[model samples]
Structures are given as structure tokens and as C-alpha cells.
Target: MKMLAATLSILLATSAAAAPGDADFAKGLLKKGVAFDTVKGRGKVPAYAAYLKTVLVDGGFAASDIAIEPVGETANLHLVWKGSGKKPPIAVAGHMDVVEADPKDWIRDPFTAVEEGGYVFGRGAGDNKFDVSMVIATLVALKAEGFKPGRDIHLFLSGDEETEGVTADLQAKQAKAAGVELLLNSDGGGGGLDDAGKPVGYSLSAAEKTYADYTLTVVDPGGHSSRPTATNAIAALAAATARVAAYRFPAQINEITRASLVAAAKETPGQLGDAMRAFVANPQDATAIAMLRTDPGSVGQIGTTCVPTMVSGGHAPNALPQKAALTVNCRIFPGVTVASVRGDLERAVADPAVKVAIGQEWVSTPASPLRPDVVAAVTKAVAAAHPGITPTPAMDAGASDSVYYRALGIPSYGVSGLFMKESDAFAHGLNERIPVSAIAPALVHWRALLTELAR
Candidate 1:
């Protein structure tokens, strides 16, 4: 019996020593290039899943505690560190799949993780892979430190989030069934930094705008371009599109956005700061709204925005087009229905010739309430990790899988502690990268947050 006990102690010590630090884990995952093809729905994701399993197992988590469920071409990795049955489990989630990257478009191969000038250049380095690595590193670090939570902590890594989010939706349902209480998603909110890389503030996203696409088409009989009729299809489509461009959705504010603006105003110095303060005090302030309109960064947070993304008209230069269409994509504010936005577009156009139809179904998700417990926990964590950086609740302009979990009645907040310059965030664009300085602080933030909430 004494020999068996000694062997178990040695095994535990070996597992604890084997856990890697946050930067090392991130480099390892980024090197795998778990790039997912939104169209084909496959990539090196299976290899990435195997990598995560190996890390967790090496961190001393039992094989039974980690479950890898395959869904189509991707898989979901769930790791549970069980605790006493006193509180519901808290789930930390990030998507494993990354958007496709072409080597020609990037300075270096997007799949290869390159460390240069205090930044990690890779495809998923910023979008989500860093967050996933942070969660894993934090959990492994906690295990190595011999810290035990009073409640279960579940790490959910979804395989499809940039495209279909099938795995996230499935896992959210599973988490709900397992009686998970709160979800801290790492894909949405984070710290915004200034030009000098100083922290502006950290945003905890409580809500996100809904995504809806609309198609406006004009149909007419084709004719010779030399003898074109007044009722040209292409011309009508162009006119309709112009009206949409000229139209602006009304500016609106909610509790979360109000707080965000208020926090931002405090940090800002000049007219921008004054404008933020005015808008927060009186959301109907036209002067402040006009000033904010000039700054693209501030405008998106205050109102629903619609813009024409795609347009196609003439088939031949010699003939009048028979049909012309434009795709209008809108990031809708919370609580607004897609039908209402469609009605607004139809009214704005006011022409019977152009037909506006829904290109995709709107998925509605209610905004998460700013629960005091969550706010306090996040605030405390931010204070510990980043002194003097205020924690502000925000509403994200882009949609995330958190909406699905929010729809399921589990309030999910985006609490990623990464701080980076807005100009450096090339997510879904060319040559994505993350600051090396941002990584260690993120690990500290996650560790502090998990300890605060679960312990």
C-alpha cells in the first residue's frame, strides 16, 4: 500500500511539471493551423482536437473527464474538472476552427506560427486560437498549482464557429442540459488599446447585434443599349441601392452600451470624449450623434447599420440588363425584428419596381442582463490583471456563438483579457496576428477570473 501511494505521488508530480505555459501552448496550437473551410467544412481540426486531448491528459486530467464528440467534419472538446455539488458549473468556451488563409496574401505562411517584433503571426492567432490556448493554459496551470475549485469548470472548444457554428450550438444545448449556469466565451469581447498600446478599457460583451442579409432586385425586359428605355433595370437597382446608402437607422442605446460609452468618455480626452459623455447622458443628442457619425469606430456601437455588400448588374455592354440585384447586409440592434428592418428598407426605397426579400433567416437573441455577480467578478479580475483599466459592459456589433447560449437562457459574457490596438486586429482579413505582450497578462486575467468565480 505504501509503495502504491509513493508511485501515485510521483505520477502527480510528473503530470504537474509537464504542463506548459500560456505562450508555449498558444504557439503549439497556432502551429497546427486548424483552418476550417466554411464551404467544405473541413481542415486540420481533427489534429487540433488530438493536440488538445494530449495537453489535458498530460496536465493530469483523467481520460474519462475529457470527451471529444465528433460532429460532421469537426469535433467538440469538453473537459470537466469536477467539484462538490454546491454550485452550477461555469463553462469557458472558444472555437477551435479558424477561417481560411492564403499564403500569397500573408507576409509569411499563415499556418506557420512566427514570433517577430513581440507579435505572433498566424491565421487564428488573434481571432480565437489565443483564447483557446489561454483557457487550456489556465486550467493546466491551476492543476499544476494544486488549486481546486469549489464548482466544476468546463472547457468547451467548438469546431465550427467562423462558419456554421454547428458544434457550438450543439455544445450549448449539451451544457444547458448539464445545468451549466454561466458561460464565459473568449471569442467576442476584449481589451481595446490606444495607438501607443496602452489599455483604453476592457469590454465585457453582454449582447451582440443580429446578422441579417437582404437582396434587392429589379427586373425588366432587355433592350439595345443604343435605344434604352427609361425603365432600365440596372438603373432602378442603382437608385434603390442609393436610397439604402442614404438611409440611416435611428441611433439607439441600451444599459450595456450606455455604460460602455460612459466608461469610454472617462478615458478619452477631447471632443470625442465629450461626444461620448453627451450621448450617454442624452441618447437623443443630435450634435453628439453627428460627431460620432464622423468616427466610424463609435458609430457602430450606437445604432443598427446596413450596407450593400455585393452588386451585379449588366451581362453585356451592348444590351440593357434584364435583371440587377444588390445584397444588403445589416447588423441589427437587439430586440429589433428582421421583418421590421425589411419593412424599413421597402419604405425607404418607395419604388414598386425594386423587390426586397430576405436572403437569410434572422436569428434573434435577447441581450443578456448585466447580472451583479458577473459584473463584480469581471471587475475584480480586471483590476487584478490590469490596474487602472476600467471594465465596461458592451454590446458587440458582430454576432458570436454567445447569442446561441444566450438564446438558451445561459447568460454568456465575452471576457477575453487580450489587449491590442484596433488597427492590428486583422480578423477575417489579411495577415492576422496578436501581440506577444498581450499573452501573459491574458493568462493572469483568466487565472484570476476563474479563481474568483469558481473558488
Candidate 2:
């Protein structure tokens, strides 16, 4: 029990390394994907989908099996690889869209992939594109090698995952109607390498936090700035935001978090490790709670977190603002309702003048149960690809396309193939990139999964 569960398993499992395919081709696909600028409102996702379709078709997939549906300026791609099995289709979840990136803030053009040192630098090089390219390449290779499956395999690529999830929402409905067995999301959950270039371990996300946004609004009669009243809207809004900021959601524990924390304790050092063990043994330990609260990485694991992300007021420089609003975004823990979090925010402000409103319709979902088939297959595939790395099950804090699928009562797991060091991750930051060397084993990973699960 001194080492983490998966960490201990990782050390016990050693095997021959997995064989790779044309990694150079996969790298080329990733670079070409980076050039598309698939951010929202760009009207480029359909074009990107077409390029992928060409690759798949040329590699042996039938062209008629792929459909590109335009949703507003963006699009969704759905592909079906038919089989003879009686079981429902297995789905692979991915997104073509990238978060908005400003080229001025980066050392290289965010849309242009540049290979420097041993990495590829671009806006989406690491986040979803890296594994996305690998998945596509693996499928193509399977088709070319005349590999067939017992059950139909579906690949769904959403167009607006970084902004609105309209595409994923639509895909989830269609997948449910068609009776999709489960989804393997490439958006989150993967392995981490320590600074020494040694594999620490891998994590497969069986659960995730819910994403919701709330607005705190205050309105007042406009007047001259020099004659501002005590009820200035901006001042009242700021105070309300401050209260919500200072308030902390009660510490909570679940099956996934408890296991994840137990694993983290073994790798963590000093007082943090001590606190992790203490909190695991007793969730009500005040000293452990206080110590864990001091760490941002550990704090969110213990509770729902709400923070003011945007605030605006004052229309004119010479006049008092007539209205002001604070936009607070929350990553609600699983099993917590959105309305309950809204209630908490309103109570924290405790001001009649300030109004808290849910900005959109969002649903909180329960964690997906750990299916034995999924866990065993992932463990086997990872051991084959990474040679000694055992994947850990976790509940990630970020929301992904899996959220929609999981909400619809479908089991979804994050099984991204790309693995890298913690420092190499820059999914939404400047100089965003990923190592070029990750392509081969990633190819092996996807191929192995499809071989076992689909076959």
C-alpha cells in the first residue's frame, strides 16, 4: 500500500514493446491537421473533415460510409465501419475544433505546425489533434491490412467542442438512437512521463466534473460619475463576486477520487503526501483539508470549484453604470445538480440587489461505472504500447465530448494514445506543442485496442 495501486501494477508488468507503423505518415497528418484553424466561427471544419475522409478513402475505407453534416459554420463527421457482429457499434469520440488562439501571443503561427527540436508546435498539436491523427492512421492501417471486426465501429468527430458542444450533443443523440455500446474519447486521460523521461503511469478517465456557468447581475439608475450613489452597480457586483470567490464548497469524496488520491499520495512527498493519506482515511480531517486546500492541483479533487471568469460594467466614462454582471464558471463535481450550485452561489452573495442566474441549460451526470472489459482491454493495450505502464482510473476535472455521451446513459472512457511528460503539455497555451516521437506507440495503442475490442 505504500505505492499507488496502478503505480505498483506498472512496476510489476514488463513486456516486449509494441511494433509501430509509418509514424512519418501520422506526423504528416498531424501537421496538416494543425494548419486547418478549426476554431469556432472559422467555417473550416467541413474542409478538414473532407481531408480526413480522403485519407480514409484512399487507404481503403468506402467513401459512402462517411458523412459530413454542416452545423452552422462548423460541421460534424460520422463514419461507420460495418461488421457482421450482433452487438451494438463501439464509438470513438473526437473533435476537430480547437480553442481560439491568438497568433500574436505565440512564438510561431498557431495554425502552422513547425517541427523544432523534437516537437511539433501548433495550437492543437497536443490537445486532441495528436491522438486524433494517430487514431485515424490506425484505422487506415487496419483497413489496408484487410482487418475486419465482429462489430461495427463508429468514429464521431464534433466541430465545436471548445466553444459550444452543439455538435457533440447531436452526435450523442444519434449514437443513442443507433445503440452505441460505448465511446472511447481521445480528449482527455492519458499517461505522464516524469522529468527523467521515465514513465510515471497512465490514467483512464472513468468520470469527470460537470461544466456550468452562472451570471451575477446588479442594476442601478444611471447618474453623473461625480455623484455616484452607495448602490453603484459595479461596486455591488464586485462585492457579490468577492463573496462567491471566498466561499468554498464542502469537501466531498467518491469512489474515483478516493482511489485517485490514494495513488497520488504514494508519488507525492512530504506533508502533502501525509495529508493525502490522512484525508483518505478520514475525510473530516481539518488539518489535512487545510493542507490540501493550499494546493491548487489537489484542491479541486476534493470539492466543486466556482470562480469569477468575467466581469463587465460602466458603459460611459462620464456616467455611473446602469448595469453590471459577473460571470462565474463552475466545474461541478459529479452527482451535484447545477441548480444546487446556483443556489450556493446566490447564498454566498446574500444580497437582494444581486441576481444569480444559470446562464445555460447544463446537466450534472454520475460517474460511469468501471466496466471490466474496458479496464482489462485498456490495461492490456497500454502494457503492450508503453511496456510496464499500467493505466490508472481517474475522474478528470475538465469537461469533454464524453460529458454528453455519459449524460445520455452511455458509458464513455478517455483512452488517448499519446503519452508525454507533464511539461510537454500546452493544450490551450502559447507555443502549444507535442513531441514528434509519440506517434509510433500511439499508433500501436489504437490498433491494439481495435484489435481486441472490435474483434
Candidate 3:
């Protein structure tokens, strides 16, 4: 009887160890992430801060270990977990803020945690809340298993990343000062399905295009509407806009993007994969680019892109305006600088009648080299959990908080290990939500990554 009881106890422990709280814990954290959005402003700050407090408490972390550091205008919440060994810590970070979403547009309240059709629908569900929850879930599960990391693990969740990345920037500076060895920002861009619905994941963003806003001004002396003035301000602005629309920043391959394209090519299917292979094998071939350009995804890999976003230059229906302007937002390539993009715009609108000046510059530093240690850790973890999908090193065309750490010379990967299907809210679109099926696999991916990297 004694031996039988001991055997039963061991089996119970093993089952608990093997099975992490996939449902209750994830649901609880997802609810927390969604509810905290209410604390966006006014009383929102305290509300969000309180939510973090709840997360730390529920995750079995001591309140004393949770530190809130105020940087400039915003404060970053830090949760530190000490491991058994003495190695430097790896920082896993995510922003707490969610972009404004119209409640009317959503089928359910954007702030309310809605579990319907195997999805948790909300504003930050895919963009970052999902990642935030993943970290909490892993930590909670690890704590239950009495699993201590060999290295100190610091999880930093910033207050504001939606508007500007100021808080995230400050957090990176602070992390580096505190001696964080590896930084992972889980803010934007990740899982997408191929045309056949096969899950494809992008790991460690190698490079991101910098965002620069250019304002083009065309000025003409005001004249009566009946007189039909020549060379009107609106007309000049339109001509310049057309020129910019027609202009294309020449294609040039950078180190990281080239590596990413090669990896993606290996994974891509059908003729697209063939063209990708051909381009990587021979970049000089004009046909490679022309063929890749036929598909939208490949165009971003080889070029700097520009799109005219906003225009404001008209005065009145009856009067010819004296001044007109349009805003052109450009996402510059990795090797290309903001100055080079500006120069390209100037050459495109060379007519003396138009004047161009940079309005707002969001500069992104070049990507860091893929650290083999981190990559191998993530790759091993992913392969163990998902047999068929091979982890690939890639670059994101969209920007993320990862750029801030990369700027500080810290090895950063935009890794969440969460598989998200293609959806608009993945960035700034509506009805954004992560699927239920992805939740379990993501947990396994993150858990493996944490365990491997901690060692």
C-alpha cells in the first residue's frame, strides 16, 4: 500500500509537470490584457499599472521583485526572475499600449475579452497582448514546476509603444545599463499562413525600413477663381504628387535582407520559391527581380517603397489657393538612410516650382547580426514542438520595438513564438484576434525557448 501510494504521487507530479495550465491561465491573462486597455488614459494609467501588479501576483512573482522604473515621461514595468546559475539575464519585452480602435467597428466590444469561435477578440490580441500573455503563462507554469532559470530572466513591459516607441527606447537603454545580454521585443509582425494555409513563422527580424514623412509644398500667388490662375498651388502639388507616385527607389540588397530572402526562398513553395532561389543565387539577374516583383511579398525584400499618405492644400471652392502640400511616407531600405531617401524625393520632384522638406523622421537603426546562441535556442525549441516547420531568419518591412534595442547594439529578435493567421489587426487593422489553436503551440514554443536560453 505504501509503495502504491508513492507511485500514485509520482504520477500526479509528472502529469502536473507535463501539462501546463493552457486554458485557465491563458484565459485569465488574456482577460487581463484586454481589461487593461481601459486604463489607456485618465484613470487608465493606474488601471494598467494595477493590471501589471495582478499579473506579477498571479504569476507567483514576489511583489518586491517587480520594479517600475520611470523614464522621462513614461514608466516601464519590470519583472525579474533569478535563476540557479550566474549568467547574465535575457530580457523579454512587450509594450502594454494598444492603438485606438473604434468600438463600433468591432463585432464585440474591443476592450472586452470575447471568446467566440475559438478566438479571443480585442484590440491588442495579435499585435502584442498575445505575446504579453505568453510570457506570463510561461512564467507561471515554470514557477509551478519549480523550474528556475540558470540565468536571471527579466521581463520588461513598457507603457507606451503605439504612438512613438519612446518608452521602449528608454527600456532598452535601461536594460543595457543593467547588463542584459539578449533582448527580445514582442511587439509586431510574426505568423502568417501561405496560400495553402500552412503556418509560416518569421523569426528574428534582421532589418526594418525606417519611416520618414516628407511634405511637398507648391506655392503660387493667389488669383481670382474666375480669372483661372496659371500654375496654381493645387496643380503644382498634384504634379509633384504624381511624380513621387511614379518614382521608385532603386533595388539594392543588404546583408540581413539577403540572408532572410535566401531562407524564405527555401521555405516558399511553387514557382515563387524557384524565383526566390534563382534571385538569391544570382541577384544581378534583372529577370529575378522582375519575376519577384510579380508577387507583392518579394518586392519588399529588394526595394525601398514610398506611398503618398495624406494631402492638405486646398483653400476654398471659389478661390485658387496660394499654398498646397502633400505628405509622402516612405519606408526606406536597410542600407539606405533617411538622407538618401530625401535625395531621391528631391530628384523625383526636380521642378523648381515645388519645395520638399522632411516633416517627421522615425529613424530605425540597422539590424544586429543573428546571434547563433539565441537563434539555435529558438530553432531547437521550435523544432521540438513543431516537427515540420523549420525556423527561418527573416526581416520585417514593418517597424517594431525591437528596433530600439537593435539601435543600442543589443542582439534583439522580434520573437513571440505565437502563430497568428494573416489578419489586418496584426498591425493596425480591425477585428484583430489570435486563434485558439495557436495558443497551445505558442505556449510550448515559448516554454522551450525560455528553458533553452536560460540554460
Candidate 4:
């Protein structure tokens, strides 16, 4: 008995001493993730796929553990790590493709994977690579330690998330076919600590709005500019754009937003929490909504957003355009379908002369089904991870591939055990990064969440 107790004590001490090394491994993974981003793989899906392969290999992913399934123009890779059967498998998902960046705007080469002043600078650093590296390093360390998960773990890596969400959608479909119990995608924003350094509750995305694009076309009889009709196509488009911008849909208080507001109120002091509560109680209150709208992070909760992204319709300076078109992208709320948004547009424009047609761009699923299992599991797990931090069930304003699964009636949740200052973390911007301190603890949180859900 003494020998056994002595051996256990030594093992525990060794584990404690070795824990700090995990941070170093995390740094190594960050280096690899930044290196992966160095290749100009945006929109080059094949290159993105190649990059993922290199990352998986370099990150110590077993060959048999990761498999790439190609769908038309997307690649969905399923990474499986066998477990000890104590729990089922949970999926950790993220996209490898980053939005395009201009080299001139960056302080360093956006693709160079530069590590200076504690930041591993790169294009996809915050947008996703950070989470990806964190997961890889955690799992690799666990595997090396002979730590089999209580449940099977799957790491789903999708290419072309920046271009479209088809890859993740397809991958979710495949997982559903295999009876995947819990699907967790690390895409939605994480919990941010407030000014007082208190951790704000994490956001477990139960839903996300649908994304739709529509092109407004204006046509007139061709003629010289000098003899043009009173209404120019561009002029008409400008008017249409103005009307769309002016159009305001009624404010809504959905389950997710309500929860988000209440939780936020608790984390904040004085006016911030009061403001959040006021907004939650009556989103229709003009003053409350206006106040919340001032914060870009909270604006999406008030309602959906429509932005005019592209416009084209002109020939020569002297010749009046025969046709003109403007494309407007709308992020439709979950309860409202594309059809309803179209109907709303029809009413907003109230002009038979203007033709509004939905574009043929890739279709995305609505937010994942807000199933009871996922909500309960995530809420419990988050609470366990950050005591006193009340997580809010929320709908992601931006679309994630989980929307694809939700559309198919498969419940998917976006939960990452990491958070940072929105201003400092550059995702889809220059100098994207995650704090090195955030990595090790996040591993513990993720492992716990996965274990809980799998069981």
C-alpha cells in the first residue's frame, strides 16, 4: 500500500510539472497554424485542402484519424480519435479559408506567420486558426499522454468557409448519417472578460440567421446621355438603395437574444447591465434599442441587417445604360425564411417597376436546430467551466456552417472555450491573434465539454 501511494504521488507531481509544457506545445501549434496561412489559399480550395493536410500532419494527427471527403468544390475533413467507450464522440469544427486581405494594410506579411511581441500574426489567426491549433495541440498532448477521451472525438475541418459554407454543410450531413450525437463548431464569438476583468459568460449559439442575396435590376430604353429619359438606371438604383437602407423591420425579442441580454446584464455593472436588461424587457422600446444599437456587438440582436454590397450598370459616359443592377445581401433572422424576407422587400419597395430577384449564390442553412440536448449540455458545460458566468443562448448574427445542419433538422452548436477583446483580436482584419495565456485552460474546458456531451 505504501509503494502504491508513493507511486501515485510521484505521478501526480509529474503531471503537474508537465502541464506548463502544454503551453509551449500550444505555441508550436500556433507557429504551424500561422505557417499554414502563409500559402495564398483563399479561393484556391485545392490549396486550402493541401494546407489543411500539412497542418494535420505537422500537428501530429494520425493518418487514419483524418479523412478528407470532397464535395463538388469543397473539402470536408473528418478527424476521428478513438476513445475508451466511456462516452460518445463530439465534433470540433472550424474553417481553414480566410477572407482575402490586402498586403499593404498589414504591418507584416499577412501570410508570413510572424511572431512578434507575443502575437502570431497572420490572416486566419483569430478568425479560426487559433481555435484549430488549440484543439490540435490539446488532442495531440492527450494522445501522447495516453489519455483516451471518455467519448470519441471528431475534429471537422472545412475548407472555403470564407467563400461559402457548403463544405461544413456537407460534412454535417455525413456526420448525421453516421449518427453523430453532438456537433460543436468553434466559429461564433467567445466569452469576453469585461473591463473589470470579470469573464463574461460564453455564447452558445443555438441558432443563426439565414443569409440571402437579391439583385435589383433597372432597365430603360437605350439612348444617348443627352437625350436620356428623366430616370437614369443608376439614379433608380441609387433611389432603391436609399429606400432599402431606410427600411426598418420591426424589432424582435427572440429566445436567444433575451438570454444574451440578461446574462450580459449580470456580468456588467450599473448602466451596462441595466441597459441590457432594459433592452431585453422591451426590445421594441425605441430608446433601449437605439442604445444597444450603438454597440456593434449588440446591434445584430435588435434585428436583421441589410447591406448593399455590389452595383453594376453602365456603358459609356455618353450613352445611357440600358440595364443596371444592385445586389443587396440580407442576413435574415432564423424564424423568418427567405420567402418572408422577399415578401418584406416587395412591400418595402412597393414598386412594380423595379425588379427584385433573388440571386443564385450558394444557399446556406438556417442556424442549427436549437435542440434540448445541445442547449442543456452547453449551458451546463459552460457553467461548470466558468463558475458564476451565466451563458446566454443566442443566435449568431453571422452565418456558420452549423446553419446547414439546422436546415436539415440536425442540431448544431457553436461553442469555443476561448474569448478575447473584440477590438484586439483581428479576425477578417490585420494582425489577428489570440493570447497565449488562453490556450491551456481552454483545452481543459473543451475537453470537459466534449466529455460531458459525449456521455
Per-prediction tally of clashes? 0, 0, 1, 3
Q: Which of the predicted structures, 3 or 4, would earn the higher TM-score when compared with the native?
A: 3
User: In candidate 4, what residue range of length 10 has the lowest lDDT sum?
Assistant: 36-45
Candidate 4 positional error at 235, Å? 4.6
Taking the tens digit of each residue's C-alpha lDDT, what string does model 1 give over 223-265? 8999979899988998899999988899899888888888878
lDDT of 1 at 103: 83
Tell me the tens digit of each residue's lDDT in model 3 across 1-455: 99999999999987764333575567667766786563244235345655776766766889898877664445678888987656887899887778888888877888887888878888777767788877778888888778878888988888777776687888788788878888877664355656454676656665677778988888888877888866788888888899999886676676677777888777688888888778777877677778887788888777888878999886888887988989999887765788878888989988888888888877567766778887787777667656666666676776677777777877777777666555523445677787766777778878888988896
Task: Tell how far residue 150 is off in model 1, in angstroms.
Answer: 2.7
Winner on lDDT between 1 and 4 is 1
Each model's lDDT: 0.84, 0.88, 0.75, 0.70
Candidate 1 error regions (>4 Å)? 1-42, 193-197, 225-230, 269-271
Tens digit of per-residue lDDT, candidate 4, span 316-434? 88999888888888877667767767777767777666798888433445445456767666666666656776567777767776766666666677787776765566787766766
List RMSD in Å for every model shown: 3.9, 9.8, 4.5, 5.8
Provide TM-scores for the models.
Answer: 0.88, 0.88, 0.86, 0.80
Name the lDDT value of residue 202 in candidate 1: 85
**lDDT value, candidate 3, whole model:** 0.75
Model 1 worst lDDT run, 10 consecutive residues: 31-40
